[model samples]
Target: MTFAELPRMGSGRVSEARRQHFHAQVQEVVVWMRQYVRRLGFAPVARSWLYALESEGKITKGDFTWASKWLADRRKEGLIPFELVGADTTRQLTGHDNFDEEATPREYINRQLRDSLEQAAMYWPSSYWKHQTNYPILWSEKKDVLKLFKPELPDAIRRFAGKGQADVNSRLAVVQECQWAQENDLQPVILYVGDHDPSGIKISDGIAGNLRQIAKVEDWECGLDEMESDGRIVRFGLNADFINNARLLWIDGLETARDEAKGTNDLANPRHPDHGKDYVQSYLLEFGPRKCESNALIANPTAARALIRDELWRWLSYAGHKQWEAENHDASKEAAAAAEGIKRMLAMFDSAGVLYNPGLIQSLAQASLPGLPA
Candidate 1:
């Protein structure tokens, strides 16, 4: 409610004029903030932004949903997904164009049924852990690193975004996600890529620290002792080794080199003071106290991907890939077997009916795969 709407004093407490004046002063600030948020929202809604607003008290915890509604209104006006929250997606019936594209009705039904059966039967392997004694990989994100990687990743792996010193909520979210993975009987292996500097270095620690604290306080199923012994976290890139070897270009001044809107960074951020006991003296010695943002590594997208692939392959092998393929082939055979009776039943009905529009199904039983009776 606006300040002006507050109950007036009975007598000599505060005048109605004073109340209105106070409200006008307060509304000036609110109006400015509302305008600012509206302008920023020309872009897609983000979980990070929602969290930020809650932290800043712009949106109260009790009214957390207000920001989402505000963003949704903007999205309806036509804003593409930044992360594509499934809840905010356009809902459609089975008659949608995507269902019919390059497909016959029988084929579509057969496909839908087969897929449902596949899910129900749980024929697919859940993860690398289910396949073997192996564990899951947790990959980290930095500015546009998501844009660089290929879409496909193994079932045993998950991805997360860390803009910088991952805010408390984001950090806690990461902790919960990793903890959930551990509960599912998968060893957590965190593989991160970010700025090769103080804040980036500390972020990895910050996440672990918060996770450890929660595990202890909450008496989680997977305790800190187990996590300390079994869990593994490693920073894999933009290291001095890769920097010197790959010769990733640098921008002498990060403050000057950044185009905040574009999110383009020149790597050499001068924010952190390079100390004698910095994590890697070689990095400081070679780069001369210069910083390297995560993008510097992926600047050569081909090499960066190759590097990540090589790291993942250390955990996953060709045998693992083939194991998945073999499982898939068996599932395909099973689905085909289950669908055979339906095809025959449809084929018989077509012959019995005088006015039957026997198009593709007729062609299928009379001509398609040999399993269906002619």
Candidate 2:
């Protein structure tokens, strides 16, 4: 098509084609998520699983909201809740509250050695990173994912409120933590997860600025004194591409959000000041104007965990993994060495005439001193 004959969006129906393709992707994502839930054996698709349903038709924001209500309707008609967890297969451990169940001296010594060895083996990554990292890891995200996500969180990383925009204290804390990270020669990374909405896009942008602003006034006598201002926030979830890639169902209510953002349906003049037309349209283009909740990912726990892990594992390396393994070996060896030293001391004392039974000895005097033999 000639330039003059081109469709206003781009080409001879090209813009229309792209828009259609984008909508198709949205529908595909919605359907995939619905199928994903149904496959999980949520027969009649329980009330809780509505946001995940992939429905048929021209997709809109309200379809998702209706899905949830549809699930509720099913429940009202007597549909059971989806079973995400298995039945109580937890076997009860033997109770040891009684003093008679206490460990003997030999057992206690062995237990200590075993525990130290296990910790060395298991926590070498923890140890290696402790010495290796130059920055503190501070992670914050929307609260909804916390349940399926808590298990995947690292023990060492600092977790913020993990819900919504960081509150005033939370924003201030970022500055304080950034200062701490800088003082320690550590790079601070903020991994953010939130909904893919007008505000979600803005949330990542303001955290650093908010921190700097708060710090200038409340922290340093002079504003941003020697502060690196180098930290960054990674919008880890509800990104534009993942909208369909993860098959997130499109929820209704974008109009309300849009209205709130612009203070009107028309984007010509938005009342939100900082987040007016540019902010709204930019995200609309990238995300196809379809919004999703972080919780939608929870429907498929394995995939959700895998997705989150993929993002987090970006922080580590093969070299780091190997280093952790080496640290673990060293830790285990340390434990083994301690056990051997104690064993040798007992064996040496047993050989001495002053000690008949090393286990029976009440004090060091019961046997010859370490340097002095019987």
Best by lDDT: 2
Q: What TM-score does model 1 achieve against the real structure?
A: 0.52
Residue-by-residue lDDT tens digits, candidate 2, 1-374: 10111011234656666866644543443445456545544322232244433332322335556545544443353332333322222343556665533367766655665566555444343453544443334444544355455566555556654455677777777667666766665656666777777666677666566566687666642323333343345667767677677666665434433344445543323444543567777876665545676656655556666766777667645476567677777767776676667666756765784345455564565455565444
RMSD of 1: 15.8
Evaluated at residue 348, the lDDT of candidate 2 is 77
Q: Write candidate 1's Cα lDDT for 1-374 as tens digits.
A: 42222121235678778867655554443444454344433222243344334434455434435656655554463432323322322243346455355357767755666576555444554344555433544446453454444433564466666666556566566566656666776555667776666456666655566566655555663644565566466677767678666665443433322354444342333323333334435444555545656655433555667667776666655686778678776876676666676566655765765224556556755664666665
Q: What lDDT is obtained when candidate 1 is compared to the true structure?
A: 0.53
Top of the candidates by TM-score: 2
Go through the candidates in order and give each one's C-alpha lDDT: 0.53, 0.54
Q: Report how far residue 264 has shifted in candidate 2, in Å.
A: 11
Q: Which ten residues in a row have the lowest lDDT in candidate 2?
A: 1-10
